[model samples]
Target chain A: MIAPLVIFDLLLALTIVALAVAVLCLRDLFAMIVVFIIFGLVSALAWVRLSAPDVALAEAAIGTGVTGALLLKTLHHLRYVTGRLGQNAARGLTAMAPVPVAVLLANAAFCGLITLGLAVAFLGAPAAGPGFEGLVAQAMPQSGVEHSVTAVLLNFRAYDTLMEVVVLLAAVIAVWQIERGLSEAPAPVMGVVWQGFARLALPVIVVVGTYLLWVGAEAPGGAFQGGAMLAAVGLLLLLTRAYVPQPGHRGLARGAFVLGTAAFCAGGPSGGQRGPRGL
Target chain B: MLEGFGAILIAMGAVFFVAGTVGLLRFPDIFCRLHALTKADGLGLALIALGVALLAGTAGAAFRVALVWFFVAIASATCSHLIARYARHGAGGVP
Candidate 1:
C-alpha cells in the first residue's frame, strides 16, 4: 500500500504536469510565464521529495527566480518592440499567428506520444541502481570537503566543476559583449516604496548570499546558490536603478568577472584531484 | 500536542496555498492577482516554515527553515511590486 507521503508525491507530480501543460496551452503570454514559474517551483518540490535539497535550492533560486524574472523582462521588452513595429505585428506575435490545423494536431499528437513514452519508461524503471553514492560517501572524508555534494563537485570532480564555471563565465561574457554599445537611458526615479524596500533588502540579500557561500562546506549551498541570490539582489537594484555600473569600473568589472575561473585554475596544482578542503 | 499543532499549521498553510492559487486564476486583473498572491502565499509560507521549524530536530535546522522562508517572503513581495509596476504603465493589463 502507498503511504501518505507517497500519495503526496503523486499529487505533487500531477500538479507539476498540470502546470507544465497549462503553460503550453495558455494563450496569454503573461499567464503562461507565470505558470511556467509555478512549474519550476513544483519541480523543485519534486527534487526535495527525492532528497536532493541542493538541486531543489538551485532550481528555486535560478530555475524559478532568475528564469521567471528574465522571461517576464523579455515579454515586457517584446511588447515594446512590437508596439514600435505597430499593432498588427504585435497582434500577430501575441495572438494572431494562424497555424494550419493539421500541423497543430500533428504536433500535439507527437508531443503526447513523447510524454506517454517518457511516463512509461519512468514508471518501469528499477527502484535502485548502481551508483557512486556509497563510494562518494566513503571517500568524502578523505576528499576534505564536509559536504558530500560539494566534495563531489569541487573535490572529486574539480575539473568538471571548473570547466562548468568557465563555460558559465564565457556565456555571461558573450552576453555582455552582445549587449555592448546599448544607450544608457536614464531610469525613472522610483517612488518611496521601492526605494525603501531596496534599502532594506540589499544588505540582507548580500549577507544571506555570503552565508550560503560559507555554508557550502557543510550544507546544501555553494557558489552557485550564493551567486543566484546575489543575482536576484542585482536584479532588484537594476530594476530600481539603484546601483548602476559606471563606465569607469569596466576594467575592474572585467577583472572580477574572470576572478572565479582564475582562482579555480590557480588552485588546480596546489589542490588535490577532488579539491582543496571545502574548495 | 505540539506535533498536532505542527500538523494543523501545515494544513492551514496548504489551505492558504489553495486559496492563493484560486485567487491567481480567478482574479479580474493582474494587480488583484498580485495582491492575492503576495499576501496569501507569504502567510502560507510563513506558517509552513514555522511549522517545519517546530518539527526540526535541531536549532540550526529550525533557523535554516526560517531563513529560507524569510528570503522567499522578501523575494515574493519584491517581485509582486515589480510586476505591478510593470503592469501599471499600460504594459500588461492593470487590474
Candidate 2:
C-alpha cells in the first residue's frame, strides 16, 4: 500500500479499536450506545475501503441506523418503566451491565483465541475456495436474475429466505403474546419544523425504498436492504408522530410478514426454476 | 480539471468531518455535541457525495449518490432531534 493509504487504514483500525474499548469502559449507557453507533459507521467505512460495498451499506443502514435507534428506544423504555425519573436513562442500563472481572477476562481470552484461529484459517485458505465462484458463474445464466447475490437468495436459496421470513414472523407473534396487548400510540410530535419534515421526508423515503426494490433485481440492493429501508421509514414516521399504524393492525403486520415468504415460495417454481437444471 | 475539483471537494469534506469529531469530544454539553456532530457531519457527507457524483460516469450513478446523501442527512438530523427531545423531557412514565 502507498504510505498515505496505509496510514489511513492504520488510523481507521485504531479508531475502531479505541471506540470498542471506550464503549466497554464507559459507565454511562447513553454515551456507550452513542459510541457504538459511531463505531458501526466507522466499521462500515472500513468494509467499503476493503471493497465490500454491500456489507458497508448493510452495516451503515441496519447496523448503525436501525439497531442504534431501536436500542436507544428500548433503553429509554426501561428507564421509564423502572421509575428512574430525573436520572439519565444511562443509569438504568449501567445498573444491569456490571460484569465480574473473572468473566470479563474469560471473555477477552475467548475472543482473542477466536481471532487468532480465524486469522490462521484465512491465511491458509486457497484463493478460489473450491471453485464455488466458478459454479455460480456457470449457473448465472439460469438464475433468473442478473445479480448473483439476489439470484442466490431469491431463487437458488429460496428455502433459506422463506425460513428467515418465518423466523421474523414468529418473533413478532411472540412479542405480541408477551405484551398480551398492543402497544399504545406514541405521543404526537409537536413543532412546525418536525411537522414539515415529516410531510417532506416520508414520501422521499418511500420513493427511495421503491427504487431500491426495483434496482435490487439487477444490483446489490436486494430484499434485505430494500426492506430494511422501508422499515426505517416506518420507524421514522413513528418517531415523528407522522403516521402510526393502529395497534389493531397486528393482523395486517402478521400478514405482511408472511406475504413475502408466501410469494417467494409460490413464485419460485413458476418463475422458471431453471436454476438447478431439474427443479 | 474535474478530477481535481472532486479531490478538493472530498478533502474539504474530510476537514468538516474532523471538525465534527473535535466538537463532539470538546463540546461542553450534550446538546452542543449533538449540534456539532449533526450539522458538520451532514455537510461533510453531502460534500463528499457531491464530489463522488462529480466523478460518476453516468447520470444514474450521480443520482444514486445524491439520493444516498439526502437520505442520510434526513436520517441523522431527525434522529438527533429525537435524541435531543428525549434528553430534554423524559417520556411515558419517567416523570
Clashes of each: 3, 0
Cα misplacement distance, residue A275 of candidate 1 (Å): 18
Candidate 1 per-residue lDDT over residues A120-230, each given as its tens digit:
998998768867888998897787668888788777888887887777777777777876653354454445656777898899988987777778779898767777887
Taking the candidates in order, what DockQ does each have?
A: 0.24, 0.25
When summed lDDT is taken over every stretch of 10 residues in candidate 1 chain A, the lowest stretch is A270-279
Error of 2 at A94 (Å): 4.5
lDDT of each structure?
Answer: 0.76, 0.73
List the pairs of residues colliding in candidate 2.
none
lDDT of 1 by residue, B1-95 (tens): 77888889999999999999999999999989998898899989999998888888699999889877877787687768766777775433332
Each model's TM-score, in the order given? 0.79, 0.80
Task: Give one digit per residue, the lDDT tens place, for model 2 in A41-147.
Answer: 99999998897776787788778877888877666655554454446444533465468999989999999999999999989898756746678778888987787
Global Cα lDDT for candidate 1? 0.76
Cα lDDT tens digits for candidate 2, B4-30 = 899899999999999999999999999
The residue ranges of model 1 lying beyond 4 angstroms of the native Cα positions read A81-127, A183-190, A268-279, B20-43, B68-95
